[model samples]
Target: MAVSPAAAADTDRAGTGDQRPRSRRSGRRRTALAFWAFTGPFLAGLAVFTVVPVAWSAYLSFFDATNTVTPLSEDFVGFGNYTRMLQDQAFLDSLVTFSVFAAFIVPLTFACSLGLALLLDRVRFARAFFRSVFFLPFACSYVVASLVWKMSIFNGVRYGLANAVLDLFGVDDVAWLFNPDPPWYWLVIVSLRLWIQCGFYMILFIAALQQIPAHLYEAAYVDGAKPGRQTFWHITLPQLRATSVAVVMLILIAAYQAFDEFVNLIGNQAYARPPLVYLYYTALGTQQDLGRGSAGALILALIIAIVTLLQGRLLGFGNKEGR
Candidate 1:
């Protein structure tokens, strides 16, 4: 009752086919394991450097920790820090100031970036040159830029470039940083941020705009659509939706975490301190109130989270329109 040759051949082919799939599955599993093994170090490092520090900071926010030689010597005062933060007038002022700064900086940066990106997108000659020129500021160190603005541009009445220009126009010397007025100082700070940041965002928008199909614009032109209306309805707004979200989020976070500019332009000398700057001064300066500083940092983080959620909701709403 031996099997025929044809039947034996069929059995062999079937066995090989079955083993092929199993071999593929085993290889895939090995590949996955190897990938995880390679990345395990990075994941561990991230936990140690990023996650642990965040958890520690949150935990320390509950204590009356100080920068003194003995951090453990400070008493554990649960929620006392938060309570004082609620009562602190300066903390409240910083919140308002930061809010105002975000309100102005975000829109200004996005609008200017979009405009510049559009302008650059239309240019044909030396486009790379213009892009490099615009984006150069983003590559510059924030501290150096801040110092330059403080000394060279907004220095003071006697030696600042801005004041020199004002003098030519018969305007008197103005206190750029010293002024505590409602909008003037904020405006100047926001302007400097926009100047530095708009270029980076412009490049982002330019990249997005380039991804859009050129044929769509040509088709619209063939159908008698004007450049302005076509761009508004078809090319510009729709293509930029995701990019706009990213840019807004970045600008929002940067605005909330603003420290270097305030530190360099106005120093920790009391007059012009944003929230983070104030927090740094509080945690390290005279009072050495680590609890208050932690509370401020936590509050700022919460505000950013809430705003990000709101923006996400708005983006969802916008995407619902078939974008």
Candidate 2:
């Protein structure tokens, strides 16, 4: 076989070219498989836990789905559950209570968090220690904290911390949770929330504050701005618009989901019932009306979405241009 050098080179080139494409295809296949392997479980969990439940709840909301979860069993009273919950006195009162709590907690938390963050930002010593100390309460659960507040701090006895303090000024023991005449329970709940929330948000604000360029403050001072109020209003606050909006949105959603503390503190009392507590008693309490509960849940979800979107619109949340 008298093969020319040129023919041998062409055959070699063809063989190399074939192997290259096959190797490339093998690498691509491996990469695709690895990605799926990593993400498949997460996707499955999302479908099972989040998607299926929401769809099922939506389906159940439209039916008289009482006592059983089997789908569409001849008790399909269309929109009956939704309308009934809308007219429910307890549900309506719960909405008002949520509004009141949000009104107080959101601004108060924002202020307290910002204040703590600013103080910590200015500190050059023991900053981490103070931050941890402030953040420690957040690790405690709502139920436990509510019990502490109810039984120890504001227990309406002379031995209680709050009442002990009041006793110093010749005041009698105050019924913090029991007395609805003055609604002193708000102080306990608000303070507990502040203790839990401020540290976390304070950490957030501190991060945001650290990101602010020092030159901005320097330039403000150069432009006849004072250090205390003037610099904060002009340079500090405007720079923190994104963080502020996010904190407000989070606080709003948390307020809407208020349940654990209220339930543990008051035990299904109608005096200051949040929507979740009210819905819980309706769905799982003595009545056990699942249909109305599902409807209420959807309505609450709608309200939350609407309010969040409105905040985003009004405050330019997620708007990069404004930022």
Candidate 3:
């Protein structure tokens, strides 16, 4: 049972197989190192910017941390801030404002985007150009758009585009964003949101509509189904349910987080302050009530979670029943 020294030497040299390149494992190890090298900074930033801030805010929610969020300045309050924020009339009004905004924007954006997608899907020439035209607004900053809407379009003067149109109709100059008695500002806000966002969601619907199997439509057509209404309701609409849910959810979240437009269009008004705007004045404004703001932030996060979950459940987003 004698073994050659040469084989043992070869086994030691190869490690696993004599024919394999010696650098393969090292190359794989280097590849893994490179992957982590590329991704490490992003992960670190997520921890520092996203995770730490969120965790710290949640921690500060239970404390009296006004004027300073540092650990040294915190005084234990144990849900007092949450209770107070829940009772605050301004905060509750902000929630109601968020609800109204969401109700107006979500359905409108969904419908407009889906309609645009359907129309674009039918276009045979210059489709990409048309899509880019519609989607170009998505690239514009919200602040810039809000300012343009406030100052140029609905600036409440005869020189403004809206007022000029009114001038055509022999109508008097009307203050759009300035008048809260009739709340005409809602028109400006909602229209601006729809113009900027509908294109992006239209692209989503376009992608989803393209994902619908042509054979399904063909099969429906073969079964004597009518083309427009019947085919759309039975085939196109049902196929788009997932994308519709996703679009609605994104719109819902965006609507709740509305701040820049509301601030620019309406200013620091009491009428239409959404929760983030209200919470901003609480935490970072002159009040500096970081504890209440943090509590409100957590509460808003919970509301977003509950709302998203409910929408998903109602829409059968995760359901396997039909799909």
Q: Best by lDDT, which number?
A: 3
| Residue-level lDDT tens digits of model 1 in 223-242 | 88899966577766876777
TM-score: the better of candidates 1 and 2: 2
TM-score of each: 0.84, 0.89, 0.86
- Candidate 1: segments with Cα more than 4 A from true spot: 1-33, 68-74, 269-271, 317-322
Q: Would you give me the overall lDDT of model 2?
A: 0.86
Q: Rank the candidates by TM-score, best first.
A: 2, 3, 1
Which model scores highest in TM-score?
2
TM-score between model 1 and native? 0.84
lDDT of every predicted structure (CA atoms): 0.77, 0.86, 0.86
- Please write out the lDDT profile of model 3 over residues 1-41, one tens digit for every residue: 13333443444456544335766555445555665677679
Clashing pairs in 1: none
